[model samples]
Target: MPTNGGQIKTYAAPEGVAVADAFLIYARSVDSEPWIPVSTYAVDVAEVNTTRNEFDKHPISVASFDMDGPVEVQVKYTLNKVQSAAIRPKSLGIQAVIDGDNTITFSLDRPRDVMLEINHDKWQALHILTNGIDHNALPSDSQETWYFGPGINNGSPYGLVTDGNLFVPSNTMVYLAGGAFVTFKLNFIKVCNSGVRGHGFIYNGPNGGAILIERSENIVVENVTSLGATGFSLTTGEAKGVTISGYRSFSSHGNGDGVDLFCSSDILVENCFLRNSDDTIAIYGHRWDYYGDSSNIVIRNCTLLPDIAHPIHMGTHGNPAKPETISGIHISNIDILDHYENQMWYQGCISLSAGDENLIEDVHIQDVRVERISKGQLVNMRVMKNEMWTTAPGHGIRNVTLKNISLDATNSQIVNPSQILGFDYTRKVENIVFENLNIGGQYIHDGMGKPRWYMVADLVPMFINEHVTNVKFILTK
Candidate 1:
């Protein structure tokens, strides 16, 4: 509980909705300045039980702001008791000073998306989302922008808003001002050069998603805070040249996936904070009407906090008959906060389950830090023919590299051993390499001391199963 505060910027939610009292958060630029209050918005997340469909809502607190420089943050837990508190991803090495019984303070040198948990309770944590200063923010009164002011807005000058759905036309720009709450699904369907940029909140009701980009091109969705989406936070299908940056989402429903890309290409998702019940970022080849080979994607510098599922998943769904290829993916510099999943079929913090005859290839995942995986494995690459989600078996998975990956399961006893398996002799996993892989302060490399009779996988806690060829672990450090 460090009492230091300074000049900083913060945002607030709308007036109609009451602020959450779970945590009292403040921010400042330096220790010598006064503190600025940051409103903690109430967000309902799910405490999911995979054995049943019925879920319970666990309300959490979230605060967001734009950081132009280094900032000091202070948080005071307002609950009755707080035995101990912690912040994650422990890989960040952010040390907190406890100045009081219920207060803690930490300093951030730059913008980061982190969670604060009191009494080691993760379900009711506080999410602090920060982004770089918007240098190209649209003016509030710009003639080219459709600005939605503060408060709940529906059926406006932008035209047809029915049943909490708004279809944005082509070449249009929409902005949600600070404290503005829009419950509509901002649909960018078949539109070109359209974007939604703001610092506001978008809430989805039940069936649909918060923001959808379908059959669209050159679309940009930046700096939008999505709250409590029952489905996905932002889903893109058959889209091209899409850029998703500085986005934040908190979802708690059954299938609350974040930033799902289906049969899309040339996408860049960076500097985003996604905390959901399901896969934080799922990339697939084909699903429903979205049909193509999903390729050329880059997901970097993002923080994925999955309360239920994988942080990075790919190649699950595809066209079996035509046999699509899901390739050209690069994921780097990511911090996976938590991954909790009980189902073995869907239990991997970084999973590549190639189903539906999809040939998954050319993937590079590097510079990642995985912290506190409560129930899932660190990695799972398998060629499967799961009838539940696919029609036929996948072709194979090839040329995948995991470099500079670190996982810290300090006190976790439920972490499953990672696996890499092929469906059969025909569908094999080939040319896989783990370069500079570190687990629990020990590097898993070939040159490390190991029994001569033991296999390479015996050096670590993973299983290099059958039908996997050309797997190597090299020490680069």
Candidate 2:
């Protein structure tokens, strides 16, 4: 956890958490020193009520280390009182050892950020973040680095509003030093070639979004912790060539999406942590004044916890006047920790609801493992008309694939079946494939018999409507 390129530092818990004395976490890359653990609060499962209290009284350990490639992570905790332990995504295959003195030691090789839990739950766990290459390295001859140290500084080149939001300008490097907690929103409007990076915290005050990248290009946001945005943690509208890595965000308010890409292209969001009340990551077309198709987006190696809505939501908004197409979106290696949505129509661990004359195609969701789904379905794909945002139904959806998705919904109350439906023949969904989809220790295949299709009711296990064509389930084991 090196900050400002200086000595490596370990962060203490923010506040109000009883640190466990029986646990110790450490990590190290090939060239860096061993990293110690930092204490942070994890949302208690019991406190996940209708009130949406994000940060509860429960405490967990978190540690971050930088590495160019792979790294080794170790956790030593008391095991006499614990029953079972496991790491999330389930694909990592880490093992544990029982040491003497009632302590348990586990080691795992992490290519990215991951979670470790005892008793196989999110109540008490460890979040280890592996930060990749530094994107904040600017040439010394470039523009002077605007440093916001620990306080309320108002002398920035970009004007600070009365509400403490910073209006970042173009062609500048803004760095918030370690331990610096700035209570402001970073606004990037119509700017290019800029970045916001640090180990500090950016707290977006009431009634404002945390980071807004609109109509900009070649922007990067890295290694920053943003807290409590009323709108979204990080949002991009009509922007392109944006790279966000190792960014951690937490939001508890309504409509507080993690990373919302609206009518943007060539965006990459990776190695991040997002716990939001709304969709963790949403890609939409044409919202407000931004009107166009969204393409070439990749969201990978991230841990998502949706306290309210879908972990991944797409194609909800589009322009009816011109009909936009959202294509070439790939999401891989994601660990969906929790998804809680009350409305059945808008509930899914992953949802692709194409509306408003939008064509959502060439989307691939692969290698995802859902550890727990409290109240939603596994997958939901539809081409329908939205009563709230669309004047017309979606055009068509084609060439979408879901591969190696395993959901352990053993403790979930999944009343509705996973769906792939179309509004009509003219606006149908076509060429959708499901491979190795495992739910509750059972694989979904043709041998399970033809799927039952339902209209306007709670569905069965796998529901494929009439207008969905060329739907194939290729299962292995």
- Residue-wise lDDT of candidate 1 within 1-477, one digit each (tens)? 111122344555655654799899888886556777888888887757657777767889988776777888999888757677777767678887777668889988887778887777786588887766656765564545677766666215335677667888888888876556787788999999988987777855444578999999999998888988889889999999999998888888878999999999999999898888889999998888889999999999998988887999998899987889889999999998778887889988899999999999999999999877888899999999887899998999999999999888695558888999998989999999999999888999888888888887876678877888999999988
Off by over 4 Å in 2: 1-8, 12-83, 96-105, 108-112, 130-144, 149-162, 409-415, 440-443, 447-460, 475-477
lDDT of 1: 0.83
Q: What RMSD does each model have against the real structure?
A: 3.1, 5.0
User: Residue 134 CA error for candidate 2 (Å)?
Assistant: 6.5
Q: Please provide, for model 2 over 1-477, each residue's C-alpha lDDT reduced to its tens digit, 9 standing for 90 to 100.
A: 233222223445433323355467655543556554544433322224546644333445555544454444556665336666666656666665544443445554434556667776665666665544445543222355667653343135335465656677788767865444566778889999987886666665554677889999999998877766677889999999999988887666667788999999999999888877688899999888898989999999888988778999999799888999999999998988887777777888889989999999999999898878878888899998878777788888899999999887675655357888999989899998888877777777655654366332231376888999888777765
Model 1: weakest 10-residue lDDT segment is 1-10
Candidates' C-alpha lDDT: 0.83, 0.72
lDDT of 2: 0.72
